[model samples]
Target: MLQSLVPLLVDGLANAALIFFVAVGLTLVFSVLRILNVAHGSFYSIGAYAAASIGLWIVSSGFSPYLTFPALLLSAALVAALFGPLVERTLVRWTYGKSEAVQILVTFGLFLILEDLQRMVFGVQSLYEDTPMALLGITEIGGIVYLNYQLLLIGLAAVVIIGLRLLIRHTRHGKFLAAVVADREVSQTLGIDTNRVFIMAFALGVFLAALGGALATPTSGVAPGLGAETVVLAFAVAAIGGLGQIEGAAIAAVIVGLARVLAIYYAPALDAVAPYLVMLVVLLIRPYGLFGSVTTRRI
Candidate 1:
């Protein structure tokens, strides 16, 4: 039983790491901006494409294989720098205070546009650039061989969670964000630059999404429809965790990851729907999500 459970635990953690990145980003954006960005997944795909392309170029140019690690981070940063501000300033900024339907429709249009752009630029073929994975080698645990890169991902996810918690709880910027989250009008009245905060928060969210995609490229490769699939799963995670809850997102990711791994092991036919099934159960039990609470608006 110990031996069997080891592989399951490893696989689940690895999967959870990727899901946590995107889900956390999604929830963060919603928490601060109060906008559910339908196009957030496009940033993920763009980051994957950039990382794979950069890694491939590095390998073909005879650069040190170790550079691929930095390349993944660079890809994410580049995506955030390039698209995050632009989207937040133009398309996303317009959706503020709008109805949910309008916000969804506008972002969905952006998603379609970005998807087509990716297809045109990168072509429809899937691209694989696993140089980092190759460099990291492999390890054995409980008689099961696992990619060392996978373990690295698990560690990185833990770092991100801790780092985010510290940032939110200890940093001055975190204080500003917390103030804004608690009361946007009060924050604005207190001389906080709400617009700047919104832009920064949105950009950070994009960075997290892109980072997830960049990291995944070393193992999964990038394809045309990857963003769509990722977005759906991310939404399920966000819903299960209760939107806008950071710790909830992390816990939900683990739950979804375990569900997926278990499905793959025991019921292959349920693999794709496992996360959604989990989401269904969670929603039924807690309509506002595990960490979410009901809000009342003044008339």
Candidate 2:
């Protein structure tokens, strides 16, 4: 039992870290931008592809191996810098203040376009480069070999949670974002440039989603339809924690992670439905969400 337990917890946290990144980004977007962004998953796959490509280049070119860490960050930055502003300015901006149906449709359309663009650029086969993982190596735990890279992921997730909290709570952009979240029209009336805020929020959302993808590249394969699978899990996390609650997303991620782990260990049939099952129960009780509340929807 002890042998099984260690690997299970390790696996759960590893899975949780990636989903946490994507889910938190989704929640943040909803909190500030108020968009469902069904296509948000595309950014994830793009980030993963970017990371794998960059990591592979570094190794193939004989660059210093330590660069892989920076490569992870750069992959996300590159995706965010390129696609973030472009998508926001062109398509996402058009959906602002639109109905939920329109927002979903536009973003989903963008998702399809971006997904195809990735295939055109990278082709359909999977890509992965684990220089980072190779550097860290492995650990022995409970008769099982655990990758140190996995633990690194958990640390990364914690840093992101704290970093995001500070970004939203301590910084100027955070205050502006908070104001937007509080009341968009009022913030605009108060001389806050809502358009720019929207751009920033959308870009940040892209950054987080892409960062998640980039981080996963070292351990996971990047391929077509990857975004689709990841998006469903992220949506489950986002919904379970409450659409706009950051802390809630984190806690819910852990719970969902553990639930999945337990399902795989004891009741394999529940593995797929575990997270959503928890979501269903929580929403049934709270309606709004565990962290969500029925409040004014004015934007």
Which candidate wins on TM-score? 1
Structural similarity to truth (TM-score) of each candidate: 0.99, 0.95
After aligning candidate 1 to the native by TM-score, how far in Å is the CA of 46 from where it should be? Answer: 0.5
Model 1: per-residue lDDT, tens digit, 25-131? 99999999999898989999999999999999999999898999999999999999999889999889999888889999999999999999999999999999988
Count of clashing pairs, candidate 2: 0
Worst 10 residues of 2 by lDDT: 290-299
Q: Which stretches of candidate 2 lie over 4 Å from their true place?
A: 1-3, 141-144
Give me candidate 2's TM-score against the actual structure: 0.95
For candidate 1, report its TM-score: 0.99
Model 1 alpha-carbon drift over 4 Å, by segment: none
lDDT of each: 0.94, 0.90
